[model samples]
Target: MTVTEVLRRFNRTYTQRIGVLEESFLGTGRPLAVSRLLFEIGSAGAVGVRELRELLDLDSGHLSRMLRRLEDDGLVATTVDGADRRRRLVSLTTAGQQAYDDLERRSDERASSLMAPLTPRQQERLADALATADLLVRAATVRLRQVGDDDPVAREATRRYVAELDDRFPAGFDPGPLAPEPDATWVVATSDGRPVAHGGLRPVPGRDDTAEIKRMWVDAGWRGAGLGTRMLRHLESLAREQGYRRVVLDTNGTLTGAIEMYERAGYARIDRYNDNPYAEAFFEKELSSAS
Candidate 1:
């Protein structure tokens, strides 16, 4: 079979094998969707309703109906968040906790039964394959989009990036804002409506032909998924689209991984172009139509 066909076949097999098509999942008289929602809420203790919608990629109306059903069944409760009165939080009730425990037990038993027929070596191979598949699927599904500098998600990503810098640098870093550049283009990489990475291209002070890349950061958890390269390439593409002929970026000496990534991406070391005290190395790449 072709790769796509093989993937489809595996998806169909797995969904059927897991009883996903059944009206009652795990014999609990609830659909797979409701059961999964309960598991998520139970695992998190308490989570914002908006967060649940983002996590599950569910519409607000659908989630509201599900929450109402769960409330009617005495399995879940929603309350206004103390810190954010305008937002609602969802949590499991006592009966909901019991149901979650039952679901967990059933899931464990089902997994064990599925593994029973496999030899030890076969099981190891299956696990390795699943891990690889999971990584590839997540990497493939990550989405990149351009947003305004002040967009809430973009601002949150910048905050996280600076927080990491402060933690990693010998001297703690300041969370100062990037220089305001009206021409700057900010891009945020998201997966499941959550920002995983961010970067941007902005004008070089006196050089209209050069676009300086700034605020490049990737979440630690997503680093190895080739997301960093994707973000870099996306910024480069943006620079090209904006009619820039060259791009420049800088990094701290302590950021050896980032330095290496830049080198691999065809960026060459350059003299200090800016007086940013924290920057220990600078790199630049000339862009062409073929780039």
Candidate 2:
């Protein structure tokens, strides 16, 4: 089968295996949607309605309907936040707690039963695959957008990036010479309005046809999700847009993973591109064409 067909088949099988199409999930007499909501609230003890909606990626009307259904069933209660009257908090009612506990118990049992037929090695591989799938799904949801140099989220992400470099480098690092230039383009990758990765392209000194990719960083938790590759490709595209024919970047030798990624992305090793004291490796890549 083709890749798309394979993915669709997996999706169908996984959903069916998880009882997603069933009218009653975990014998709770409710669909998976509301049961999930109850489970979330129960897990958190209490959660803001806005947070719930964002966490579930549910539209306001759909979330309202779900909340109403749970409320009607006496499984959850909504109360106005004392600190913010405009916001509402959802918490499980006594009956809701009972239902949530039952759901959790049944879900764990179901998972165990499903995995029982698998060999130990197969089970481990399945768990690893599921974890990879979850990370890739999260990576796909991240949004990349250009922002001004002074954007707060971008600044915060840059700060985190620098701190990480200091932690990773053999000697502590300095950020003094890495200031953004007026003509540079900055890109930030965000998930749920929080910046999770950053990269930028700046003009090479006295060079109109070439640009430098700088400050490429991905949040630690987001590292293995291929966000770094996404950010690199994004910066390259931005460089192409700005009329640059080539892009260059430098990294510390301690960043073996980054070095490997750069090589895989077709960045060729080049001579020292700049006088950055911390850089131990440099790379360059020529753009195919600017769209």
Candidate 3:
């Protein structure tokens, strides 16, 4: 088949296999936005409004209105925060729990029905492709939200990254213990709410606001999916926002793809500036005109 025909077939098969056309995919006649919020909040017995806002990317006003309507409909109950009375905590009522479960069942049914047509082998391949695509698209869509150094997910990604570096560096790699208080602007990349990629920038000691990128890593199956480029661009944008005119990064020669990506993305070779044992190649990209 021609390449265009192959792509068309792939797209057609993918949407059919993934339940993309289901209108009642979540069990509620409500919009997917509200149903998704209900499901997420249902998973957590009591989730903070602020966290709901961030996790769902909902406007505070809109989320508040949704919560209010849910409350009036006796689906969810809201309470004043113990430590901060002005803030609210939302929890599903028993009635709301029933509704959430109904929605969950319908979602599971629709998903199962989508895959029922494929043979076992075809199902496995489809599932694998979807998983990989989800990770890659998520890496591309990661919005670079500011995360504190102390966040557990941030620390976990750092540990995973450091472990990979240790394997790749001929000189052996030790990025020191996970430093939770580093003056870093960190971001965690999540695919379907699971962290899959991470990179960050922090002060380069006496260089004022100069930030060096560190702990850059993407999950194993995600490497060649353009995650390196996305993470680097995100780190650079964040560094520039924090008054950093230049960004520096270090990597090992064993990571040829990363090296190539950095060079093509505007990083120029520079002398190694740190004692990081893993760093065989150092790069710097000036960002005076960064957005």
TM-score (C-alpha, index-matched) for candidate 1? 0.88
Give each model's clash number.
0, 0, 0
TM-score of each: 0.88, 0.76, 0.64
User: Candidate 3 clashing pairs?
Assistant: none
lDDT of each: 0.90, 0.89, 0.79
Model 2 C-alpha lDDT per residue in residues 220-277, reported as the tens digit of each score = 8898889999999988888887788999999999999999999999999999969989
- Which sections of candidate 1 miss by over 4 Å? 148-152, 170-172, 175-183
Task: Give candidate 3 regions above 4 Å deviation.
Answer: 1-29, 81-87, 145-198, 201-211, 219-223, 234-247, 251-272, 277-291
Task: Show the colliding residue pairs in model 2.
Answer: none
RMSD of each: 2.5, 3.9, 5.7
**lDDT tens per residue, model 3, 202-286:** 8898897578988788878677778777788878888877888888898888999888888899889999799875678999888
What would the per-residue lDDT of candidate 1 be over residues 66-127, giving only the tens digit for each residue? 88989999999999999989999999999999999999998888888888899999999999
TM-score rank, highest first?
1, 2, 3
Backbone clashes (count) for model 2: 0
